[model samples]
Target: MKITQIEIYAIHLPLIEPFIISYDRYDTMPSIIVKMTTDTGVIGYGESVPDDHVTGESWESTYAVLKHQLAPAVIGQNPMEFEKIHEVMNKVIRDVPAAKAAIDIACFDIAGKTLQVPVYQLIGGRFHKKFPITHVLSIGSPEKMANEAAEHVEMGYRSFKMKVGTEVMKDVERIKAVRERVGADIAIRVDVNQGWVNASTTLRGLRAMRDLDIDWLEQPVKADDIDAMVEIKSKADVSLMIDEGLHGVKEMREIIAKRAADKVNIKLMKCGGIYPAMKLAVMAEMAGIECQVGSMVESSVGSAAGFHVAFSKKNMTSVELTGPLKFSKDIGDLHYEVPFIELNEKPGLGVTVDEAILEELCKFKDVVKEG
Candidate 1:
């Protein structure tokens, strides 16, 4: 079916809680919602969260670009031409990756519904029904972060990804203190959000935390410096996962081929959507590298979409589906009440959005070619 219309919404919603990562604090999701309508009357929904610091995409810029530029490119194209659409959108627009990702996912959802199958099954059948989620504790004092880690552990979470960037000593000290409280059995992953100035500093901090047993050091240095990344990966004994470095499938392959990283963290918003994320997952798997799926602290819409990717990939490693937990308040009750979601017998992605929550949480709605 042809995609007849593209709907773009500028959603302004407050975060239930302020989420502090390495670079900055996010008071709201500051995301753009994309809706694509097909000639056959199928509808698909997608969302993109732009990282002002990391991705350089803002709400006004994404809305203007999508409405003025990208939307016209695929107006009459086949709805399933995600790859072609992706290429056209990228070539036309400069670097609106987050906006591109929203459209990509909307198209995928449409294709999945058109075929009467879930998005995961469309990619390849099923992988696993349920995935164990990891919690991302916001950046705070060492004791506060540690206490938060301990609290999540009490709630049955086995993995925790903490934000570390501001003060290197504090970041290292927090890990050490938290590890002391949580003990050796629990997995502790650290994301620096590209805080290190150089590889030497990254190595120095990593060296200090060596005995604390960090599960993985994420994007410790800048994303562009492949030389530094590969070098860091080679020298460090700890596992290294690249986040900001992933520009596209080719870069991911290059890193994996060169052993630039021990693991790869694929985010739906960052990679432009599920199409590339799944491709990266399969590619990483073939090359004997492990990939973990994460998100941009979006609402249930984005989180649910990510769950499908994480759940459907068998070669998938640990899941970083922490948005639901990171948010002070989540929009929907849909995640909790789904059939076959009991880790078995789940036929599809195992998620459906709650209409009431959608109405309540959304500050504004953008409808394209509304029926």
Candidate 2:
């Protein structure tokens, strides 16, 4: 059936705890929710979190593209024709992968609902019913971060990713404290978020942490500096994972060719959606690179979309789908219990919106249709 109407909503979801990374601090989740209704009466839902620093998208930009640009492109098209939809979406807009991702997820949801199967099954069938998750310890003082790590460990989380790259000495202290508190078996990962500059500096910092047994380091240098990344990766004592550096399969291939990183972090918003994300996962796997599935700190809708990709893929070595866990009021029915999520049997994403919160928090809502 063809898409009859598309609804877009802008809402700000308060975070359970204000979190800080290398780049900035976030106390709320800014989301653009996309809902598509088909002629057969099946409804599909999707969510997009706009981060100006990460995806180069803001709330106004995401809303404008979805309404003025992407809407007319696929208004009356069949959701099953997702390739055609993606083509039109790209043709109408240049960058704004987050906006395209929202539409892409909604289309996937529609297709899965029509077929009476989970979105993971639609991708490649289920590889595992429950996926492992990694809890994040926001950037803080050494003692505070270490204490947070201990709390998460006590709560049954075996893997933890800490925001680092502010100061080499502080980072070293932070990791050492956490590792010492949690003992040797716990896995600790760090995301620099492009804070460390140049190969020399990155190498120096990584060298300092060499004895700490850090599992992986993410995006130590600026995203576009492939040569610097290559040099740093070669000199680094720990395995390096590229985040902002690789966008999709094309970037993944280039990074692989350059031997820039040991692994790659895949996010639904960065690559557009589940379809392209799956392709990227396979590409990384074939290239002998491990993949980490993450998010832009969105709600359960977007988290569920990420879970589908992570669940269906075998090479995803790490998961940080802690978006729902971060927010105090998640706008969906999906349940999250730290490191593990039990996927429901319902078709599509299997997440229903919390209408009460939607009405209270939604700033804008609009329906798009064919002209």
Candidate 3:
């Protein structure tokens, strides 16, 4: 069946609290949702939660590209032709992976629904029925961060990711306090978001936290600085995981060749969508690199897409799709068993989108159909 109409909606979801990292603070998350209707009377949903610092996309830009360029490019195409659809989108526009991701995700949703199988089944059968999710703590004072870690521990979360990269000494203090409060059994990962700025500063921060038992340090330096990553990896005792540095398989190959990082964080928006994400996971597996499926603080529509990827791949050892937990309201149905995200066997993304809530939350809406 061919795609006939595409609907785009821009919505702002209020965060439960301010999500502060090294470079920015977010009190609300802006997301773009896509609805694709097909000739066979099948409808599919997708989401794009772009971060300017990561994907270099914002709500306005993502919405604009979807309405004016990407959506129209995919009209009259078969939703099952993932590669052709991607090629068409790339020809119309370039470097807007988040915008392309919305269409790609909707295609997968359609493919799964048409085939009457879950999205994971379409990729690879489920390897994990349920897995523990990593709870992320925004940047805060030492005591505040420690208290938050303790609170999550009481909630049955065993893994935590802490935001760092503001100040070397204070960042060390933040990790130390959380480690002490949560004890030794709980795993803790640190993300700098390239806040340290240079290899020297990152080495200094790493030295300060040498005794804290960090599971891994993520993107300590800037995204484009492979030399800095190599230097940091050579000097630091902790494992390095690249986040912003990796977008697709090409970056993955370069990192492997340079020995820059021990792991990679794969976000759907960064590499386009599940189609490319699966390719990245397979490439990581072939290269013997561990992968983590990360989120852009999306609602259930996007998080469910991530969940399907995470559950199907064994090399995706870590999961950070906790965005749904941070939002005060969402438009799709996703169940969280405290520390674990459980998936259903229903077709497609297995998510039920509340259209009324979506309409209420939408600040901008547009429909692209054949003229």
Candidate 4:
């Protein structure tokens, strides 16, 4: 079936609390949601939560691209031709992965619904029906961070991702306190969001937390600095996972060639959507690099897409799709059992969207159909 109409919504979802990282703070997440209606009466959904600091995209730009370029490009095209759809999007514009991701996700959703299988089956089948989720702790004081970890532990969460990349010694203390509070059994990872800015500071930070048993350190330096990543990996005892530094396959190849990182964080927003994300996971598996499916603090519509990717791939050893947990309300249904997110057997992303809720949350809306 061919896609006939695409609806775009610009929404602002309030976070339960202010989410602060090394570079920015957010009390609300702005996202662009896409609704694709096909000729045979099948409908599909997608969401794009762009981060200017991460994907070099913002809500306005993402919405603009979806309405003016990507949505129109996909009209009248077959939803099953995922590769061709991506090629057309790339030709229309470049580097707005978040914008392209929305259309891509919607396309996958329609394909899955039409094929009568889940999105995971289309990719690689389900290796994990339910995976452990790493609840992200925003940047805070040592005591505060430790307390938050303890609280999540009491809630049955066993894995935690702590935000760092502030002061080196203080960041060390923050991890130390959380480790002490959570004990040795709980899994703890760190994400700097490229806060260190250089090899020396990252090395110093890694050295200070050498004995803390951090599962891995993520993106300590800037995104483009492959040389610094190589230097930090060579000098430090910590395992590095590149997040901000990785986007497409080219960057993945560079990271693999340089031995810059032990792991890679694949977010749909970073690499476009499920289609390219699966490719990245395969490339990482070939390179023997473990993968983590990360989120851009999306609602259930987006997080469900990520969960499918994380569950389908064997190499996606870690998951951080806890964005739904951070939001007070969502437009889709997702089941969260503290540390794990479970998926249903419904076709496509397997998410049921509440259109009324979506309308309520939308700040702007537009429809793109054939003229």
lDDT for each candidate structure: 0.75, 0.86, 0.92, 0.91
The 10 consecutive residues of candidate 3 with the worst lDDT sum are 204-213
Q: How close is candidate 3 to the true structure, as a TM-score?
A: 0.99
Model 4: residues with Cα > 4 Å off, grouped in runs = none
Better of 2 and 4 by lDDT: 4
Question: Which regions of candidate 1 deviate over 4 angstroms?
Answer: 328-371
TM-score of each: 0.90, 0.97, 0.99, 0.98
- Flag the better candidate by TM-score, 1 or 3: 3
Q: Ten-residue segment with the worst summed lDDT in candidate 1?
A: 337-346
lDDT of candidate 4 over 1-371, digit per residue (tens):
89999999999988899999999899998999999999999999998999998899989989998999999988999988999999999999989998888988998899999989999889989998678878899999999999999998998889899998888788888999999999999989999999888899988887777788888899989899999999988888878899999999999999989988999999999999999999999999999999999999998988989989999988988889888889888888888876777788899988899999999999989999976
Candidate 2 residue runs with Cα over 4 Å from true position: none
State the lDDT at 278 in candidate 1.
83
**Candidate 3, pairs of clashing residues:** none
Q: What is the RMSD of candidate 2? A: 1.2
Which is the better candidate, 2 or 3, if ranked by TM-score?
3
